[model samples]
Each structure stands twice: as C-alpha cells, then as structure tokens.
Target: MTDAEQQYESSKPLFEKSYPSNGAAEPAGESEPQAADTQQPQFQTDEAFASAQLTLRALVSSKEAGVIIGKQGKNVADLREATGVKAGVSKPVPGVHDRVLSVTGTLEGVAKAYSMAAQTLIDSPPPSASSLSSGTTSIRLLISHNQMGTIIGRQGLKIKSIQDECSVRMVASKEMLPNSTERIVEVQGAAESIRLAVWEIGKCLVEDWQRATGTILYNPQPKEFGSSSSGGGGGGGGYSGPRVRTGNPADFDSPDGADQTQNIAIPADMVGCIIGRGGAKIQEIRRVSGARISIAKQPHDESGERMFTIRGTADENERALFMLYEQLEHEKVRRQMEDQEQDE
Candidate 1:
C-alpha cells in the first residue's frame, strides 16, 4: 500500500453499530441509560470497519473467460459498483498446481467478491478435475509487464477499488524466474471464479489497448533515408555536418512510464474479439492511433505466453485509449439492451 492508502486505512472509520428492540423504545429510552445498541449506532463506524486485506481464490478452464467479462468488463464493473469493491486477479504462484487464481481486498469486499465469483460459477460451472478429486476448480494467468500497470492502476487506486468492490484479492503478481530480472504474473482463485475473473480482465483490457499502424494518424511519420540535398554553406575547409536522423516516437516513452496498454486476464481465445471481424477493427485501431499492436500467442507457456503489445507516440497512445473506451462503451450499451431483452 502507498502512503495515501496507509493514511486512509489509518484514519478509516472503526466504530461498530448495534440495534435495539423497537417495542421497548419508550420504557428503555425515557430517563434511563441508553442501551448499548441505541447509544452507539445501527452500524459500526470506527471499531467495526477494518482496513485489512483479505485473500480469495477461484477456478475455471482457460477457455471460459470471455463469457464473464461481458463486453469490456460491463458485468464485473457492475458487480464492483454493486458491492463496493474492485475485483481483480493476482499472478500465478510457482510450485503450485497450474490451475489456481489468487486475489485480495478488504474483508467485506473479499466476501462480496467471493459471492460474485460464486454467482458466476453457479451461472456457468467449471469442468471437474480427476487429479485433485475436488469438484471445485482453480486457474492461473501469466500477464505482461505493460499490462500489469493497468491492473495496478494509478498509484494503486484502481486495484484498491477492485479489491473493495469485487471481494477478490489482488496483490502484485510477481515471481522470480531463472536467468532474468523480470518476474512472472500470477492470478489464482477458485476454478470457476478465476474463470470469471480472467474473463473480466480480458474485457477490461479491450478498453485500454489500441491498435496503431501506418495510416492517417495525424503525426509526422519517420522517413526512410533519402538522397542528400546540396548545401552550399562551408566557411573554410568545405566541411558539411553529418545529417542527423530523427528518432522513433517510442524513444520518447520511458519503459517505466505510465502504461497506456490495457490489462485483460481472459483466456487467449477472447483476444480475437478485440481484434474484431477479419482484423478490420484492430486495423482501424492501428490506423487511428498509429501504434503497433500485437496480441500474445496462445497456449501460454514460458515461451508462448499470451500477451499484447502497443507501441506508439503520446497522442497515438491517447487515441488508442479513446478508441478502446469508445468501443467498450458502445458494447456496454448493446449488452444492456440484450440483458433487457432476456429480462423481458
């Protein structure tokens, strides 16, 4: 937790609330010492509310993430808004079964997140496993570094929000690997809940990623080497300075700078949805943003892990953010209509 979060926790309301029997209101209240419940409040304020983290887990097959996300996190977002917590996934922990996802949040939030995961699981149960002999499920995800920033959010506020709303716990997804300074991202949870969590992740990422290509992006494009034009300015020894070529726009962005890419933990299968029909939509994203975009390969292994890369200038990056957000907003309205239809 950062300083602000720590401060928020330190100063969070801690009182607890109690209730009194209404039938005894007059006899118990008039000229008598107030009952504990009545003297306090109906809810806990300082003593009742705790600011500690709660751990959660989920499970599901790698293929079912898309169904849970619901078009750019509409379902999960709704869940968070309803529950007052931010639901998110943590990275996979090594030396454990391949099928597990981990998460974290406040106590009540974690409970609520678990409930949401259960709801998703009940909505679509995961496949059973014979190895563990447990009908329950679990799953893990390996995410890209760039994507991690989005999951973590601005100064960790986004993640905290997810923790508070989803009841799911989300810690830094990092693990040490051999021969490299980079760490792996791990997200473990109940099999079915993990499925939904990742699905939500994938949908959320679609809102952040943007495609850029060699198109009408209103920025100056890098030029290929050209024949030199004759220059006549030579004071004494006829010495002409070497031509300086401009650098790539990517040069301006620091590897440690704010991440413009989106984070989605959905199964690799859902990537195509973001790509759109016949790659037309992704192409459009690229055209509009002028950022290079690449999705992670499927069947995630150390070598073939699923991921996406977006490279572009500041304006182009902003453009990508806008396009993805726009697309998600449009999809959200469409889903709401569909939900209304099903309800009717």
Candidate 2:
C-alpha cells in the first residue's frame, strides 16, 4: 500500500479506539439488517482538534467486513477521510434493530458524515427492481497490467478526462496492494447511464479484441433487462434485445458497429497508464461509464485472455473511452516514478 493508502487504512475502524458506553438510537426505518451485515456510525466533537467516536456492527461477517473495509480499507478509509468521520464497528443494540449503528460527534459533524455515507450509497445504482435486486446491480471491474499505462496518462490527466466527459462515479480500487491481480475499480451511477458506459467499454474492447483475436466479435453483457427474477419472464422496451450470453459474448455483426464505437482513443497510451496493475486504474472507466470492457489477447503467449471490452449505452461508450484516456494519464506518471526509482 502507498503511504496515503496506509493512512487511509489506519482510519477505517475510526471509532475502534474510543469505546463508548451508549449512543442515541434512532429508529431504523425499514432497511433492517439480515443475519449478517454491519453498519457503523461515528460521533465526534465539533472542532478539528477534538476526537470522534464511531460505532459499527458485528453482524457483518468477516468476509463481508473485508468488503466494508474495502481493499486495504481504501473504500472504507476513503469514506472516513472524505466525510471527516471516524468509523468503527459496534455491538448490536439488544432489543432495537440489530443494524442500528451509533455515530456520535458534533451533531452537525455526525450528521454530515452520516449524510455523506448514506448519499454516497444511495447515489449508487441499486439492483433493477425487475431483474436485478437492490442487492446485485453493482458490478466490479479489473484492468490488465500492460494496459494500465494506457489508461492513466501523464500526471493523472486521462482519468479526469473520462470523469469530466461522463456522468459516472469511477474511483481507484482502494484495497488493491502493489502488484496484486485484484486491483479494484468501482463504477456506479443510474442503471441506464451505467449501462451506457458499459456498452462504450465493450466498443473499446472490440478494437482490442480485433487486434488480438483478429475479429470485432467481442462484446459485454448487459447488467439486466426489465425485472424478472428467478421466477418471472417477459420482454420490456428499453430492456429488450437478445438474451445475454456470457461465455459466447457476441457484438453487433452490423458493419457500422465500429463506426459507432470509439471516442478519441484517449489520444495516447495515457489511458493505459491509469489502467494500473492489470487494468485496475482503468477499470473504473468501464464501470461508471457503464461500458463492457475487455483488453486484447497477446499473439505469442497463446493463453487466450487479453481483449478488454466495455458494454453499455452510447453516452457510456463515449465516457468510458474518455475515461480510458484519463487512466493512461495516471499510468504515465506511475511509470516515470518507476523509471526514476530504477535509475536511482
């Protein structure tokens, strides 16, 4: 983890240090916790100097805890730093709702922090009422190592490009450690917008796929169509098309597909730079922009796992491409730093 990452981790369990006796319990509306799920609230004094108290839930199993904390606490830690709240887990209130998280601080501070955390999540694209549950609409994306440089370009310019161009929330995977395959990129937004971004990502993948597989057949699968869970089935407008096939992923056979896809190519490998170790940096581009992304396979290696594609709507495709450029910008700076270290 980088120094910044370390600082972020030190804070994930923000209220862990100040063990409080009691916290004012607010009646939870309807979002009750299941057998396993934890929520934390942090309380703090109004001043910059005063310490804050945070409370969390033990109901969150270790496996789930890891996600709450995020890769190396990147996501969780980020939640604290961004909102200036100290977060930690707490015991369940005996009679009240088990998920009640206690956060204490300056009434305003606590409220602000709580509000930020809530809105951040609320802003997140929930599962489709029809097919996707409020539980599973969100998806994860990982970039490739070689492609990292292409996304993050010089001095972090490319990623910014994507963000500016599209209406999606894309961020680096905080939990990612150095040289780990699990670099995380979170892409979140409205379902339609997110889907659009995913489609755009797929377009890029088509290019890379063509370069690698010598064909433009690569594509990304949509998140979900009009709602139908394990039981229901029907077709709806805006959600209708072909049944998505994951393994046999296919793209538009129509010749215009290529002309329709591609947005500025990020102008350089700057997009690649942000891709990070195995495309972590650039994965957000695919996610937030709602693009189905894929990198291209190499020729000589002969393994078959390269082409990167992002799938979603038209705006999403454009935004993902723009983000891809931004990733390249981030990657360039990273490489220069590596080169400097090597020279030293």
TM-scores for all candidates: the values are 0.25, 0.23
The alpha-carbon RMSD values of the candidates against the true structure, listed in the order shown, are 20.5, 22.9
In candidate 2, position 212 carries an lDDT of: 19
Give lDDT for model 1.
0.38
List model 2 lDDT by residue over 23-113, tens digit each: 3222211221111113221222224213323221112223333444445546555656765645542212223221212233332344344
Off by over 4 Å in 2: 1-138, 174-182, 209-344
Give per-residue lDDT, candidate 1, residue 63.
Answer: 31
Cα lDDT of all candidates, in order? Answer: 0.38, 0.34
Model 1, residue 156: what's the lDDT?
A: 46
Error at 254, model 2, angstroms: 52
Badly placed stretches (over 4 Å) of model 1 are 1-138, 174-183, 211-344
